[model samples]
Target: MNTVEWSETLLLDFPPMDEVHHTFVDLLALAQAAPDETLPQAWSAVIDHTVRHFGNEDDWMRRTRFAAADNHIMQHKVVLNVMREGLGLARAGNMAAVREMAGELAVWFAKHTQTLDAALALHMRSVQSDAPARRTNRANEHPVSAP
Candidate 1:
């Protein structure tokens, strides 16, 4: 089975996202290489990281009002749900199902990172860049309630 190795190509240029994604990649690597005896634990680790990673991104999207937030969030929901299903499969002695899901996830991740996630990073950068400007302009504008 092909594993998704972390590399420069996967860097989203957003530190927080990158860090989370790095952890995810590493955890996923462990799952990919795990022997049958430990595959469940390794896969569980990946799922744990994924829960947080996807939550953070989804939160950012909603907070930043990213244009595609709904679509992006739905994708996250679907992927996460499918991954969760793999856990049940693993527990049910369906190791093969878990293995296949892991391979498919690797492929899904690379594409999702480059496309949906890349767009999110760009949107985040734009929002963050505008924040200071918005703050700076506050003093120059009409005060809502001067304190």
Candidate 2:
């Protein structure tokens, strides 16, 4: 499996988002390493984490009135649908599909984090600075080094 290697380059400098993203990377690794008999459950956990992760970002977009909201949400939806399909295939004993998806996801995840998610994190910070009361105070919670 082509696993995503979490690195300083992936940091968004936002605690909540970074925490979720770290969990995402870990979950993806779990899915990638899952044995054939346990792939279904591992993949399911990834799906669950992904839904929550996407939902959190969607909420941030809605709150901040992000200009690329529609496109971002659409991307999330499409990816989730494909993941769900892969889960189904895995349940049907097509573990290869899930493994393949995990590899593709490693590639997709690095690109997505560098682009879309990075933008969102910046936007959220901008929103926080522009309206301190509207944004939750999570910036100091994770203490990750910024890129």
Candidate 3:
């Protein structure tokens, strides 16, 4: 299977959120590469990371009182449910089902980032500019030079 990749252009311009988004894509790539026998473990890791990322986003939205927080949270719930059901199929060794799930995940991430995350990122910038400034400064100061 080809590795799934996300480009920097898709980032929401928020350091923490962008990092988590990239991690999610990486996890998806790992899941796609896992052998049938190890698929369950790989899927579990993806689910765990997804849940954590969603939770972090939810917390930020709630703390900031973003207007569409409820809607975004609801979308997260739907995605999680879909992922759980897909994991069940993967655990049963259904390769076709897993592939379908991966496709759905990729589409969902694209839409979610463009719509929901874009809105959140804008609101966050308006309300939390200081946080991003600090994050950008830290990232600049400790650039991870390629090995």
Best by TM-score: 1
Quote each prediction's TM-score.
0.92, 0.88, 0.81
lDDT tens digits, residue span 1-147, model 1: 768899999898888888988898899888988888888888999998899899989988876678999999999999999999999998887889899999999999999999999999888877777776676788777533210
Model 1 residue runs over 4 Å out of place are: 140-147
Candidate 3, 1-147: lDDT as tens digits: 234678976798877888899999989888887778887888889999999999988988887778999999999999999889888998787967877687778777878888899998888777664655556678857442210
Clashing pairs in 2: none
Off by over 4 Å in 2: 133-147
lDDT of 3 at 133: 59
- Candidate 2, 46-106: lDDT as tens digits: 9999999999899888766899999999999999999999999999999997899999998
Q: Which ten residues in a row have the lowest lDDT in candidate 3?
A: 138-147
List, in order, the clash count of every candidate structure: 0, 0, 0
RMSD in angstroms, candidate 3? 7.7
State which candidate, 1 or 2, has the greater TM-score.
1
- Candidate 1, which ten residues in sequence have the lowest lDDT sum? 138-147
